[model samples]
Target: MDHPPRIYCYRCRKPDLLCICADVTPVPTRFGIVILQHPQESRRTISTARIVSLSLTGARLFVGLDFAGCTALHSHLAAAPGPVYLVYPERGALDVVDVMAREHGWPDGAPTFVIIDGTWAQARKIKNQNPCLDRFERVSLSPGAPSRYRIRRQPRGHYLSTVEASVLLLSRLEGSEEAFRPLLEVFDRMIDRQLSFKSGESRRGVRRPAPRPEGG
Candidate 1:
């Protein structure tokens, strides 16, 4: 059987041999990020967890629908020392006000952060299955600007992808909103590539859109 000549992933707009994904390294931060990703989200070609984990050295990524105590995530959580803050949206459950209040009351030290990397529904499941997480305070973001991530759109304006949420948390903890600028820039570039690939695939047979300018 003649298979169509293997489309080079770069040409096909998929992950190429030299794709940036392979070289992703973690960055250091005051808060450690433990991302529990849903298995489905892990398999996605456009997984944002990959982006965030790669960009942050202090970050660890785990993939699963539920944490069953036997999973690697259990070990990680068991080893975590600081207070864990769950990054989720929904005002009453966990919000900035709650964390800020705790931070003020604490006699010493900051908290460790646990961010769930999946759809809002999947994240809630993660929280429910991992009873240990309940011991930690849940964290919700302050109302903010719209998400820059285009591939997966959140129904609620306040909801953010895992990477965005992590970046926000780091920014607040480090006392410099600008610290996360590099992470966001890297994310923006990745999103742009995904968008470009989709556009090309959508118009495979139609007149090609003008290529982006050389500098971009």
Candidate 2:
């Protein structure tokens, strides 16, 4: 039997009925955002990297692995207006606030943030493979509220969604939490809509396929 045509939103790329495009309002930031997304993560329907890209002005999104050889990324890193930092939770990484307070104080221009978008293991792989990123200073977030991302199970409770992490970082950098509030609102709405869609499917008695056994 022929399936019904699926209508998708041109901007958000989600199904038309679940599109959150109207809720998106691009927020400006002094700091540049570079998102390196894993190929698998880019394909996830519930992934937030796209939303983060759309929400921040001048944000760059590059997909794939081994960015060490990416000339464009290397050029961007070289020409960044201020210090470049990788947003990962490495042992030696400084908290965002502490980084702002240290040594010469905040730089004249906003720092560039390199965020890896993927699962914890995938993120680790990206960091490991990209030797070029090793030169930049690493930064991490201070302990905050538990993650609001309910759709996916995080390896730990502290892990935030890509968008959540971006918003939190921006809030600290901008020194005004109010400015980045809309991004979180949009993210929350997206999650709620997805949950509603799943509920509808259940009500219609559409059974999800059972999980496949490993190595089966």
Candidate 3:
């Protein structure tokens, strides 16, 4: 039997047909971003955390559930030039836009936004397991447009992908949406390509073989 062809895009680490690296552009930002990604999310072909890291200059990506023992994370957090805030939707979390407005464009100082990249359950698990995250101020996004991550169905209508959340946060902080709009455009194109691939698979009508009888 002939093996399948291996055509991979080294930059994105995705198969050639699903690669979006050529369409991406890295944007500069005043605020720092730290993405704590669950190990499982990092392996997904459609993971947006990688896109987020690639799109933003100086953004950091760390993979794991427990960061309390991570000296790198501790050092990064400690060296942050300004305040550190966790982007989460916990009960006491404040709306990020509101927080920014009240401070008059981050008067306290530009913030280092830490985002947890994972599914809802995985994100919650990371938060629960990582004691180091407790030291940061928690922030949430105000109700806005619905998520455009069409390939994956979210449990709720309001839950945005990690990249979407990051884009919104950055747009709001900069007081203009144009800077981060390219990331959204890239995300949209990625979804469209994936959907087309799925449609092609459906048209091809690939099916599993039926089980044989126990008594042949």
For each candidate in the order shown, give its overall lDDT on alpha carbons.
Answer: 0.68, 0.86, 0.86
Q: How well is each residue in 1-216 modelled by candidate 2, as lDDT tens digits?
A: 345787987676678877777888988988899999998788667889878888889898888889867899889878888889999999989998787787354456678999999999999999999888899889998647988898888888789989989989989877898999988898889899989989998998877669678478
Off by over 4 Å in 2: 103-108, 208-216
Residue-by-residue lDDT tens digits, candidate 1, 1-216: 333453334321336521455434556775668888888677555667766777777678777765665567677666665667777654556665557676774455446677888777777887788777776666777747888778778878877777787777777667677767767766777777768877876887535458678468
Candidate 3 residue-wise lDDT, 49-138, digit = tens: 878888899899999988878999889888888889999998988887667766676665678999999999999999999977898889
Query: Least lDDT summed over 10 consecutive residues: which range in candidate 1?
Result: 5-14
Worst 10 residues of 3 by lDDT: 206-215
Report the error of model 3 at residue 144, Å.
1.6
lDDT of 1: 0.68
Best-to-worst TM-score order: 2, 3, 1
> Using TM-score as the measure, which candidate wins?
2
* Cα deviation of 63, candidate 2, in Å: 1.1
Q: Higher lDDT: candidate 1 or 2?
A: 2
